[model samples]
Target: MSEQIADTAPLGHAKHIRSWGNWAALILLVLGAVVMLFPLVILALNAFKTTEDYNMTGPLSFPAHMSLEGVISFWNTTDFPMKFANSLLISLVVSVVGVLLSVLNSFALGIGRVKGNTVILLFIMLANMVPQEALLYPLYIMFKAIGLYNTQWSMIIIFTIIQSAYGTYLLSAVYGTFPQAILEAATVDGASRWQTLLRIVLPVSWPTISVLFVFFFIWTWNEYMIPMAFLMSDSVQTVPLALATMQGQHTMAATDLAAAALLSIIPTIVFFVFFQRKLSQGIVAGSVK
Candidate 1:
């Protein structure tokens, strides 16, 4: 009876410990959520405020009344629609092309198991480690030489290569673990490598690829330094460039700067929200196998 009582005591104690651990985790998550969301909430509040109201009430306080003056000023001053179009175009192109390149490279390196693939993947991984700052001067000189400087094409090509390198490294690991039986059945059925990739590999691996697509889009959209270095023309500048320009001027009001930031982030927010379900699915699929 004493032995059984001792065993039950440890089990109850473990359950108590687990319950405390769960509560601690929950509290940490709540605090983390508040930390993450507080700035965004403040930004939204300030975006609707006027200079007078903002200065009078302060950033921590709600607007006395919603105003469009800041939003309008920011929109017109930055040529925001143009900036929005440029960012959208660049991000979409990079995401699509980057994913395609990743898929093809990963297929060869991972599924086909090509010669020297380890060396190649190592080089690709190394390329990802190289800071964009280090390559800026060379990229500028090369783009200028090719007459692509100050153009969106320069940004597109640069990011496509950059993003594809990371994607290839990741997707390669996923594909390396692919089921051999499926590939064998496809080959026995007289499907060529290209057909197998198209019909079998691509569909099976799409969840992971979708995750990459969303990441590429968001990453490209948020890029500031590369875009700023490569794109000089105001008409060609991306959303981040425009926002930076707005913030750089000492004369710009706080409310106006907040409004510009809010406007700049809206598209990305919408993009993620639209693809949220797909992103969740991709993450789950990637994790399971």
Candidate 2:
């Protein structure tokens, strides 16, 4: 009886230890989530506060009274709608153009097996590694000479070209892992290169395409430096440019700035939420091969 009791005691103790470990892990995960979310929570709360309340109260504290005055002021004083439209237009155009350019470049390098493909790819990868600031001055001079300065098209083309290298690299890696037999079969069946890419490859690579699309959209939307450099006119200012101007000039209340920042993040968050599953799958697909 004592032996059985001793064995039972150890078993119970083992179970207790495991239960404690699980609980500890759960607590830590919850705490980490809270830490990550704290800034966003603060931003949301402050958006409804008056400038006075925002300054006086702790960021974590509830507002003494809720007010939409900050949001209203932001909307009225700033060209929020126009800035949003400009950003949206720029982001969409860049995303589409960037993806198409990347796809074509990747197909040429990966499937065309063209002479000097590796050398060209290496040059592009090296170029992508160079800091943006390093190229800014030269780009400015070239754009000025071409009369592209202060035009939205200049911003679109610059972003698309700069972004294309990474996108091409990513898509090439993906295409490299695709089965060669599929390409061979298509060729044997007399399917043209364009048809094979459009029909066979793209059909199976939607996840990667979605991932690139979302990535380019987010990058272009949040892009500040390029737009700031090329889009000098107020009429051409994107959302980030407008936000920067607002903050620098102190034309908007602090609460309103917070609100604007939160608003800017909403589209990005929505895009991610909508495509999160596909994004994850694409990442996994890329990593696995």
Q: Stretches of candidate 2 above 4 Å error? A: 1-30
For model 1, what is the C-alpha lDDT against the true structure?
0.93
Q: Candidate 1 regions off by >4 Å?
A: 1-20
Give the Cα lDDT of each candidate. 0.93, 0.86
| Per-residue lDDT of candidate 2, residues 1-289 (tens digit) | 9999998998888765657779999999999999998999999999889888978986778889998887776666668888888888888999999999999999888887778878888898898899988888999999999999998889898989977888998788777677999999999999999999999989888778889999999999999987888898888888888778878877677689888888778888898899899899988876775
Predicted structure 2, TM vs. truth:
0.87
TM-scores vs. true structure, each candidate: 0.91, 0.87
For candidate 2, give the lDDT of residue 57.
85
